[model samples]
Target: MKQISTILFSTVFFPLLQPVWDKEPFNISNISKPDAPFFLEDAGIKEQGAYFRQLPDPRIKSRIALSLLKTNNEKAVEILENMLRDEKNDNVISDLFICMYRLRDKAKITYSERIKKYMEHQDQLIRGYAAALYFIKTSDAATILTMLEKENSLFVQELLWNELASKPKSCNQEDLKKFLQSKDSIRRAGAVRVLALASKEPDSVPKLKKAAEDELPVRIALAKALKEMPDAGNELIAKLAEDKSSIVRALVASCAVSDKRLKTLVKLSGDKDWEVRRAACETLGGSKSPEAISALLARMNDNYEPVRTAAEDALVKINPGEDTIKKLTEFVKSDAHRDAAIRVLGMLGAKNSALDILNVLNGKAEDETVRRAVEALGRLECKSAADAIASKSSSKNPAVRKAVAFTIGRLGVASTFKTLELLTKDKDASVVLEAINAMGLIADKSFNKRLNEIVKDVKPSTSSDMRAYACWAVSRINAPTDGMMEEMKKLFLKKIIPMEGEKTYDADYARAAAIMALVEMGGKKNEPSMKAAKSAISFFHENPFKTKDEDSITLKEYMRQIQAVMNGTEIKPELVPTVKPELVTGKVQ
Candidate 1:
């Protein structure tokens, strides 16, 4: 059995490398005539034959075949047939086969015989192409299986496997049962997959359970199969959880969502493997049972960072009763659990918890603890806590000041503009950047002159972030002064335009801000602004930004807006600064 498996693996898994033939035909209009073979223009058959006989580049020959077929010339079928007969280039032969398959329906009555002859061709590549074409037209699973048994090319075998697997309803239970007992692992694995898809049948459970007790690969496959089988019971899940393999345990943990499986997950949470524990925590977190919550809270002090983090997240989901809350409140005073406790309180979003967080921020707790507290207060958006948070803005610690600036912005309190303006010139570059960002959120035009000065400083010591945020802040003004517009254009055309296509986060942000500023300041009417708009289009084309959050436009949509603005068309309200009320409020809604 082992020797047969080895022979099957070697024969069907190591075929020659060839381009995959899955895509539809290329657009005919996109193909250039110059790419065609040199003999394509010759009217005489003899000259075309001569060119085919001495074809140097197979790609050029293939392109000629494609071009001929695209024009629907009467001679296209004849040319393809001749190329398939004599072409030594495997790539050219493959291309000819695809072209022939596409033109098969048009060939009418002769298509069957042509495909049959190619299936019997000595070259496996041609034979594989024929097999693919046959399945598309016939959907004959038996024929595909027969060809797969003899096919030596892995690519073709894969194509055949996909065809068979796609129509499992057509497969017989007896045939799938026979495949489960095959000596080859690939056959066994594929059989299990097909049976799992039809797992609604009473007999599938027995076969899957028998296969689950096999080797590691088969066991992993069974785990995946059972994930979709809603009828899968706790006994099978528990048995797999006890398997020596951590991966098997992890898989079991992922699917262990029912009440019966909760005990198994608790056991796996302490399975001596961090991955198993993390997976168990993930499952338990969603369980929302008191038992699961107890298990996660205990694991909060786990040795591994990821496990501890997972437990913290799981506790948040469960959101235990007052006793659990009281315990966490007391844990906040412990040096070891303080940070995690603070985070859990924030996630709970209870007003009472905000008091503890406020005390930490007001007192001289560790900088890291204070930072976490500030973040929690911001997340809660406790309007009453705004003054407490702003009191820390003048602390000598840059990290604390940075946190304060961010919290103020998050709160969007219009009263803090005076405090934010003072920190905009702090010695720390990060403090200055965050301050400028906060002021931009306030959206008052009074700071336009100060922001312009920051942009015009032009000193090598000026941080790019400060300049970028300054540009962004100036753009947020309800109406910009003439001098402000001139300064923004100079900063954009000189600094931002040249930084196009940069992959760094700061550079991308700066360029995006500069473009928005240019458009807002009416620089779109000038030549330099038009040039910058064009550059913006290319910049986003190369590096399209994507975000799961719906608050911002993706890079592709941003480019469309730039194009629209340049062409004197109205931009979408959502895509422009006018609709962004958060810009004026100094908060991200």
Candidate 2:
């Protein structure tokens, strides 16, 4: 530890205390040492001259070296040049190259020779570093090109090729030609990228065609360049749409629709890869051409969800009216298309078809399909399904029961309070949570006894949600007992408000509802919980329903209402009728 400390402090203090060019240690070699803490102070103050003179420890040397270059330190150029001579730390050398490359005119011509020597250093790190500096300086392109012939690291070669590709049009044309002629396929692919990006000359077209047909990366680069070129990119896209590489084919197909390449794009809708097929569907959706819509409709049943989703999304974009709706209805009757159709119907506001979804939930579909149908029915606000949804409150599947609870809550049916109250003892934390939410919607005094019992004796896993819902239920009952409000305050401070960053994988919506309940229960007496509720309400104001779950969104609004009560506000008049104001008024109706 003693030796470690000595090494740690040595580099930090050495350069400050010594002459700028001193080759020996400041303590013994006649070099003057400057004050140490002043250097740290100057670095913090962003004084480039003082910070550049500070010696960075070899361990975190690159950080300090990069800092000097970022500050544009001219004096540090000599220091970086000196570090370049030793080849032990390649990362340090890479940082030094970045430093000198930025301060190019300050770098001596002899530094160029050292860079050339580094190109043959056996390590790809050093060679790639040297290639980058050579390209950035627009010097020694021929030498770097020759070194590319012997380089083997794929990542390093890729970087070197990109640097070469970014060079000015007038520089290194001959070297790029030799790369295109190289027997190595990757090097040849790299050459294709350079010509396509650097020149933009017509002479490179045949080479791009050959490269795009042979390699995936080269095809991607060519596809991007073609997309940027006026009209020409569309033509190349049509050709590459048939390429064997799915990724390349997909990228080109994505670009094709924007450029009106529908004929070729329609064929790509049947591409072997789902990703390519989806891209084709997306492009067809954007087309104004009638052919495009026809192609997308055929792909609506493409066996892949992304492809199906893209097709459905495109159909909505085209506005095909009743024909599209009829197709979706027919699609929903098939087992494979049923789930996707339900999602589309929800997005389409097909509220009248909620019975169809309810039937699917109660009938032959699998558990997963039933779950989607239940969620869709909830989103459609199917009031007529109140009895059907309430019956599923005892579903063996927790997710189904949770969904039913939310649906029943949304319908705002007072008579179903007994059914929801029965779910308070459900073993699934999620189901009990939704039941507690449903109780707040109904606000019946008859249900309060069971709610209070469950809230008092619920499992630790659900104590927070139970306490919160109980608080909300207690508020609705308007039946505050000796310790009810105080217990509500304790629940807020200990369970909801105080436990920041606690890892609870249980539903956040349930947690938020619990917080809302505390706010409503605490009302005038629970000041601290009220203050915390204000903060929690403010936190969620911007994006209350991040989960995209309707139940979560409703809970967020409930929390906001609780905050409003704390602030002495009234419920919005429009929502008063639908939300059933008696649930909040706390008076016997």
Best by lDDT: 1
RMSD of 1: 15.3
Write the residue-wise lDDT of candidate 2 on 1-589 in tens digits: 0121111111222222112111211111222222221112213323332333343444355665665543322445555666565535667677667666666554442466667777676667667767677666555556667777788888678877766666635347666767777767778777766676665553336766666566566677676555444444555677888787887788777763664477888889888899988988887777756677667767766778889889878766665556666776776777777877777676676776677777787787666676777677867888776776677766678888787777676677766667777777678877877777666566666766676665455345556546645666665555555344445433433333324556322333334344555465557475655555565555555544344453343344445545655667765521211110111111222
Q: List the residue pairs that clash in candidate 2.
A: 17-33, 17-34, 226-233
The alpha-carbon root-mean-square deviation between model 2 and the true structure, to one decimal in Å, is: 17.6
Cα shift from native, residue 48, model 1 (Å)? 16
lDDT of each: 0.63, 0.60
TM-score of each: 0.61, 0.61
Q: Give the TM-score of candidate 2.
A: 0.61
What lDDT would candidate 1 get against the real structure?
A: 0.63
